[model samples]
Target chain A: MSLLAKASAAHLAQLMGPLDSPAFDWLRTPETGGVMVRGRMGGAGAPFNLGEITVTRCALTLRAGGAVGHAYVQGRDKTHAQQAALVDALMQTDAAATIRTTVLEPLQKAAKDRNDSRARKAAATKVDFFTMVRGED
Target chain B: MYVAVKGGERAIDNAHAWLAEERRGDLGVAEMSLEQIREQLSLAVNRVMAEGSLYDADLAALAIKQSRGDLIEAIFLIRAYRTTLPRFGASLPVETEEMACDRRISATFKDLPGGQILGPTFDYTHRLLDFKLAAEGQGGAAAEAPASGAPLPHVTEFLNKEGLIQQEVASDETPPDLTREPLEFPANRPLRLQSLTRGDEGFVLSMAYSTQRGYARNHAFVGELRIGRCAVEMEVPELGFAVEIGEIELTECETVNQFQGSKTEPAQFTRGYGLVFGQAERKAISMALVDRALRWEELGEDNVGSPAQDEEFVLSHADNIQATGFLEHIKLPHYVDFQSELELVRKLRAEATEAMSEAAE
Candidate 1:
C-alpha cells in the first residue's frame, strides 16, 4: 500500500483542510465537555478490548472522488474530525467536479439531513411560556 | 430552522458495533486458533519477540493475531505487556562456549574443535518454489540424529590460548539496557552495540554492505558464528545465588577485522560482534561488521566519513517501529492549521492582485 494508506492520527491532523471557526472564536466560546474516540491497531475483528482510548473524531468530504475522509483524535472535537476528513478527501483528488459530486455533496446532504431531523424533533417539544397583562390606562 | 447536532456518543457506539460485526464477518468460517498462528506464522512471531524484547512465543503469537498481522503493532503490544511485567532481577550472561550447538561454523579456521556442522540451513537448497507446500501436502519427516548430547568447545578458545586473539577481561560493571534508557549523544560502545543488536535486520544489512562496498571497508572475516540454546539465569535476592530462569535460542557472531595499528597501539586484530535472539545468521553477521566499523573512534583509527561512523544516525534510525510510527502518523487531522494557511495564501494573492491592478491604471 502507498504511504498515504498507512498515515496515522497525528499526520491526519496536519493534513486536515480548513477550520470552520477561527482559533480566537473557539477560544472565546465557553468550555464544554469534549468528545472521545477509541480505536486499536488491527482490522476490525473480534477485537480484544485494547483499553479505552478517548478520541474525538470528525468526518468531512470534499469536492473529489467519492472519497469519504475521517479524522479521529483522542478527545472530543467534531469540528476537528470533520475538517480532517474534508482535508483527506481533498488530498485524494485534484478534479473539483469529482470531489464536489462524490465527497462534498454527500457530506453536505448528510449534514443537512442531520440538522433538519434534529430541528424537527426539537420543534415538537418546544414550549412557549408567557404572562399576558391587561394595560390599565 | 436549525438545531444543535449531538449524536457523537451514539455514533461512536454504533460505529464500534458495526466494526465488531465487520471483524467477525461470516462467523460460519473456522476461527483462527492462536496455536495456528504461533506454529504457522513463526517468522512473524520471531520478529515481534525480537523487536518487543520479549521471548514468550504464545504472547507474541497472540499479539500478532491481535494486530491482524501488523508486526510493529504486535511488537508494541509485547513491549507494553513486557513493561508491566514485574522485574525480578537481571539475568547472568550465558556462557556461549557451553552452548549446546545446533549450528557452528568458523571462517578463520578450516577445521575447528567442535567441527563445522552444517545443521539446518537453506544454503544448499535450490531456490525453486516447492509445489508440494503450495498444494498443502505434508513435507518429509525430519531425520532425527540419535542424541549424542556432547558439550561443545568454542572455536575462539584455541586462539585465546595461543594469544592470537584478545581476551576479554571480566568486569563487574553493569551494562545498560538501551530500551530502558533514553539514547544520548556520544553513546558508549556498550550502548551503541546494544541498539545495533536489536536493530532492524534489513537496515543493518545495508549499512554493513555499504562498508564492504568501500564505504568503511574494514576487512572482516567471520571468526565464528554459532547458533544454539543457552540457559538464562536470574539472581534471587533471597536465594543469594543466581538460578536458571529459562532457556533461549541465540545467534552469536564474532568477526576478526584487519586493523593496522594506529599511532599509540601496535598492529593487532580487532573484533566485531553481534549477539541476537534466535537463529538469524545474516542479522548477526551484519551486526558484527557494523559494530566493528563503529569502533573506529575508540580504536584510534581515522574517522572515515561513513554512515557507520555516524553513531547518532545508526543508533537512532536503526529501529523499524520508531521509524514506521513517526512516518505513518501523518494521516491524522490538522484542518485548523490548514485553514490558517489557506487564509494566509488567499490574503497574499489578493494583496498582490490589487497592487498589480493599481500599477496598470
Candidate 2:
C-alpha cells in the first residue's frame, strides 16, 4: 500500500498494463480531498499543523473475485486513486503473485534507485574540509 | 460604511475575457507548462505552498501561472482552492529526524556526521547574471559520490546529550488548528509554529530581521539547517497500521538561543525551530529567529517589547490573503459614504456663515 501510494500515477497506469473491461466496481467512487499534515515541534515534541496535502482516495471490489480494496494516495489524481484501489483489490485475488512481480517490484526498484542516486549526488557535495597548518608546532 | 452597488456584469465578463488574453502574453511565446514552473520556478512554487498552506507542487505551479507570477496572488488562489477540498483526516506528525537530506549544514559545528552537504543552493553564486541562461544554455553536470543514506543526527542533540541545551518535551495532545478555530491571544508554541510556517515570507523575514537589530534580541546560532525530503504517513483503519502515502521536500531550521535560566534551574541553551514546505531555507531561517523571540516569556526572558515577541500582532497580520483582502477592498466604490461626508462638511460651512452674519448684525 505504501509503495503504491508513493508510485507515480502514470507509472502505476503503465505497470497496470491496461485494465480488464470494468475490472473493478467502485464500492466508493474515487474522490479528491485534503489531509492536514502535522509536524512535531523541535522534531521530537508535540505535533502541530504544518499544512494540508491533497489526497485522492477510493474503495472498490474486484469483478472476478469479491476481494474489496481501499487506497489513499497523495495529490488530486483521481485516476491514480482508482488504479491504486484496483491494484489493492487484485493483490488479494488469485493473481496476487503476478501483480506483485510486475507492479510492486518495478515501483520498489524505481523508488530505491531514485533515492540512491539523489543520496549519491548529495554525498558528493559533502565538504572534506582539509585543514592547513603552520610549522609553529 | 459600504453600500451595495450592482451591475458590471458585461464589463466583468469582458474584463475576465481580456485577462485570459493578457495571461497568454505573446502568442509567439510558447505557453508555459506546469512542469516547467514546478521544475525551474520551484522557489516560487515553494513560497506559494508555504504561504498558501498547501503542499501540492503542480497546483502551486498552476496558481503561479494563473496569477501571472505574483506570489501573493498565487497564494490567494491556493487558499481559495483549499476551501473546496474535503478534508479526510490529519496525519501523524512527520519525523524530520529521519529525513533523506539533500543539503545539511551547521553554523555551530565545524564538521558533523552526514558532513555539510551544500546541495542545490544559491549561497555562493556571484550576483552577476549569466547571459547563457538568458539564451537558454545548459549548465555543466554535477558530480556524484557514494552515500551511506544513514540519518544525519541533529546538531542540537549533541548539546542536548550534555544537558547544555533544553530538551523538547514530547506530548500526545493534538495541537489546535487556526483554520478550524479562530486564533486567540497567548497562542501556544505549536500554534505559533503553524502560523509562522504559513505566514507571509516577507513579513516573517522582516520580523526576524528586527530581532537581529536588537528587538527582543535572542542570541541565536543556526544549530542546523537542512533541506531534504520526508515521507508523509497516515494510519489506515482497515490495515490497522500507518503507511507512507507520499514524500515532500522540507527545509528545517533549528536555532539555538542563549537562555538565562530562571531561579529554579541553571542556565542552558534554548531552541527556536522552523520547518516548512519544500526547500525554503530563507523562510525557515527567519522563522527560527522569530520563534526564539516569541519564546521570550516561556524561557523566562524579559518582555523586550519587540514586534516578533507579540504573537497576536504577528500572527494576525501574517496571513497575506487576509491582509490583501482588507487592503484591496478599499479600491472598491465608496460613493455613498463619500457623499455623506461631503454633506456634513457643507453643513458645517453653512453654519459658520450664519454665525458670522449674526455676530456682525
Candidate maximizing TM-score: 2
RMSD of each: 30.1, 1.6
A1-137, model 1: which lDDT tens digit per residue? 01221123343344333323212112112111211111110111111111111223334444323554544322234454444445545556564465456544555565445434533333332223356877876
How well is each residue in B66-179 modelled by candidate 1, as lDDT tens digits?
Answer: 777778878778777766643334555556766666677788876565456555667768999989998989677444433334455766566667766545555444655555
Report the C-alpha displacement of residue B295, candidate 2, in angstroms: 1.0
Q: Give, for candidate 1 chain B, the lowest lDDT window spanning 10 residues.
A: B141-150
Worst 10 residues of 2 chain B by lDDT: B257-266
Cα lDDT for residue B358, candidate 2: 100
Q: Write the per-residue lDDT of candidate 2 for residues A61-87, one digit (tens) a residue.
A: 977768998999988899898888888
